[model samples]
Target: MAGRIPHPTLKGPSVVKEIVIGMALGLVAGGFWKMYNWNEQRNVRAFYDMLEKGETSVFAEEKDRGPD
Candidate 1:
């Protein structure tokens, strides 16, 4: 075994590749978060618009109330 040559060691993924993957994942997550917030805001705005138009009520009727 003294005359035998040594084999080269294998390397893991490069730092640049890892960084790019992380950035892509972050972007996807951020996009989803933004979309969710936008949808929530839109729903809230629609509810408020309906309220302004007197299309809905937030309180129960007098007959539906239980105590004084």
Candidate 2:
């Protein structure tokens, strides 16, 4: 019986490709998470702003925005 060994990389550009992919994905994910957190903080601040405006109604904000 005979066995063959596999080459880890075909002497190719694996390292450069891996680094580029890692950096690209990191930037995309980081930017997305940053925007998501910013949006959430703005929303919470707006909620408290409305509450301070004496706009607190028995109904939901979205629903209460309509006429009584």
Candidate 3:
């Protein structure tokens, strides 16, 4: 065993690659989250507009009621 030389591990490049991949994934996830929130806000604003125009209701009518 003493005659065999130890092999060096390539850790630096592997760690850098991992960090880059993590940042890319984080950015993609953050973008999706922002898009989701924006869509929700837009929908809420549309609903409020409809309500102000008397085109929608906050409570269901008796004829539109479902099973209890």
Candidate 4:
């Protein structure tokens, strides 16, 4: 347990490269995730309208089909 220890671990730009790559991927994924949520929010009003219009197609699929 003895070596040149001044932030010594792969003593190169390895850590910086890793951090940059990780940040880039994380940013891309985060942006896409935000876009998806924004889209969902944008379409929420239409979904609610469907619900308000007595539309059961979406949520009533697994419900008990009652007597004729």
Whole-model Cα lDDT of every candidate shown, in order: 0.92, 0.87, 0.93, 0.84
What is candidate 3's lDDT per residue for 5-61, written digit by digit as tens?
889986565887899999999999999999999999999999999999999999977
Candidate number with greatest lDDT: 3
> In candidate 4, what are the lDDT values of residues 1-68, reduced to their tens digit?
77866874565668888999999999999999999999999799778888789774475357777997
2 or 3, greater by TM-score: 3
- Minimal lDDT window, size 10, model 2: 56-65
Decreasing TM-score order of the candidates = 3, 1, 2, 4
Model 3: how far residue 31 lies from native, Å: 0.6
User: Estimated TM-score per prediction?
Assistant: 0.71, 0.62, 0.74, 0.52
What is candidate 4's TM-score against the reference?
Answer: 0.52
lDDT of 2 by residue, 14-50 (tens): 8989999999999999999999999999998888888
The reply for model 1, stretches above 4 Å from the true place, is 1-10, 60-68
Taking all chains together, the TM-score of candidate 1 against the true structure is 0.71
